[model samples]
Target: MAQRGGPAPFPDNPFQDPAAVQPRPGPELDAYNPFESSAPPYQVPSAAPPPLPAAGMPPPQAAAQPPRKASPTEPRNYGSYGTQVPGREKAARPPQGGPRRRREPQGLAFPPQASAAAATAELLKRQEELNRKAEELDRRERELQNAALGGTATRLNNWPPLPSFCPVKPCFYQDIPVEIPADFQKTVSTMYYLWMASTIALFLNFLSSLAWFCVEPSSGSGFGLSILWALLYTPCSFVCWYRPMYKAFRSDSSFNFFVFFFVFFAQNVMYVLQAIGIPNWGFSGWILSLIALRKNTAVAVMMILVSLCFTAVAVLGIIMLKRIHSLYRRTGASFQKAQEEFAAGVFSNQAVRTAAANAAAGAATNAFRAP
Candidate 1:
């Protein structure tokens, strides 16, 4: 016989042979080829039967229970827009009771309905209580302030503090109220308007000068000089002359008056010169007009117009000066007062020591000229 690879075939009945008494495939092994071998068939263990319960003992309940439904008034653990979160439950609701009395808002009191006299008496009683409370508060505030201030209410020792904006003591601008009278405030306001108008006039004069420059290139220097004058004179006149005049009128100070007079006289002289239109002064619009008339009529007309404007301004200023003179009388400024003020200023001035040097120089010049 030929040799084979698998185990030799045996009897199908395991009980027939002592070796075959072990578990076998039985008749099912016939379906499989005798030469082929595979892993042993899976064996399932038999399940044991459950035990019966003892008498009178019940079955145990499950660990997890279903969620209970919430009452209508109970607060829910809602997320966004009434969506409930998983595993989170609503809070337990309070037990329902009898109908609730409507509560009024806090701090609002309702008086009882009584006779008119009784109501009036109640109102008066409340008012008196409020007054007593106010008095108590006021007393406490006073006590606190007194404690902070070391007993005295008046600022006897402490110097009056300078204004927040001012970094130094004795700021004249801060002292404006004390120096300038309330009645003179209106006058100062008027003066401010006048000052603003003069500044505007200067600008207009510059524009006119520019127009002249457009007509003649020779007039360009004059226009440039006019511009320079406007820039310089605007701030100078406001600060130096106008302010000094205002101070003079505010207080009858002789030094301030003399300062104002000298500066104002010079200013008036310049205004008159501007109106006259003198040659080579950079403001000779009238002279320019007369000369240009022979050449260009348009240029001449423009110059004449500008010149007339200056003349009008000068005349108006003269009139305003006259008005200011009348107002100055009301300021109580007199020759005697001015003399006293001048003396006081001379004594106090830092420049008084330098005066002797100037006087000696002047004397030397005079002595040289005399020979």
Candidate 2:
């Protein structure tokens, strides 16, 4: 009776265990009666018999019955969406604080591949880039071939401008095109020409000083000093700053770069002083040139022209200094690297090692008396 009236029961199947099937909904749940006006709350009568009256003792008259309250007949809807059955409710939820279970996906899904045209387009684009790279490589290859066959390969160093008959052989081999990288070649050539210009300027200053002596015999001392300056600075200038700069750019040597910076800065300072033309100085500088203005127009003009040459060289020196410094910075050379190079070179020299050993031996002897 309790198992067959309300709704369909779950069936016996392999997907569910038959022994574990839940009890079916019963007839009592389907008997909810919310429409009757006078009906008392329906209560199932008990199976046990009612109490009997004792010997001539009648049961006390039942108390007057209370009126039955009527319930509303129309049902109101809650927000639940699924099939709702009476007299059944879920159990309370478990408490907090446990590892969450991993949810497995209900189904496997594979996204579709891209179109064939898209893949072909990507492949073509990559092929084009490869072709472009090949073209660039071929161009560079031709440049290398030409350079090997006809360019710097055939050139030789003819610096010092010395003749074959001279007893002193050429001291240095300098071919800028061959030794220097292409990026620095133009700058190196400019510096080389500037050196020649400076040489010519110094010689002109001597000739101007000689002209001064001819105009004023008492000023012969400057002329003599001018000759000395010409002969001394001509070769010294070549050896000092210029050669260091050449070597610096040639090998990208930090030590040589530092050497060039130190010496060339001093050389620029000398150029400035020479341009000023202090009295009794070998240079026909601004002072001597201006002084000649009162004596002879021709001498003053020649001296001023020489001073201008010196000034030009000074200006060019400053510009080249900045240029070389920029190049040096780009080469990633630092003073610490220069110091390391210097220390290595010093220790590697056989003469320096010999001298150091001898000095150490003498020091140790003096420290510990003769043994």
TM-score of each: 0.43, 0.56
lDDT of 2 by residue, 1-371 (tens): 33766654655474585555665667976776556555556678699977887888978677896754545663555635443575565664656786667786776543345466778889999999999999977755665575667664444446677899988776676867556789999998999888888899989988898888888898878889889988988888889878888888877889999988998898899899989998787889999888999999998999999999999999999999998898889889999999999999999999999999999999999989966
Tens digits of lDDT, candidate 1, 274-330? 767664466745776687688778767766876786777677667767776787777
Write down the lDDT of every candidate, Cα atoms only: 0.68, 0.83
The per-candidate count of clashes, in order, stands at: 0, 0
Name the weakest run of 10 consecutive residues (lDDT summed) in model 1: 152-161
**Cα-lDDT of candidate 2:** 0.83
Best by TM-score: 2
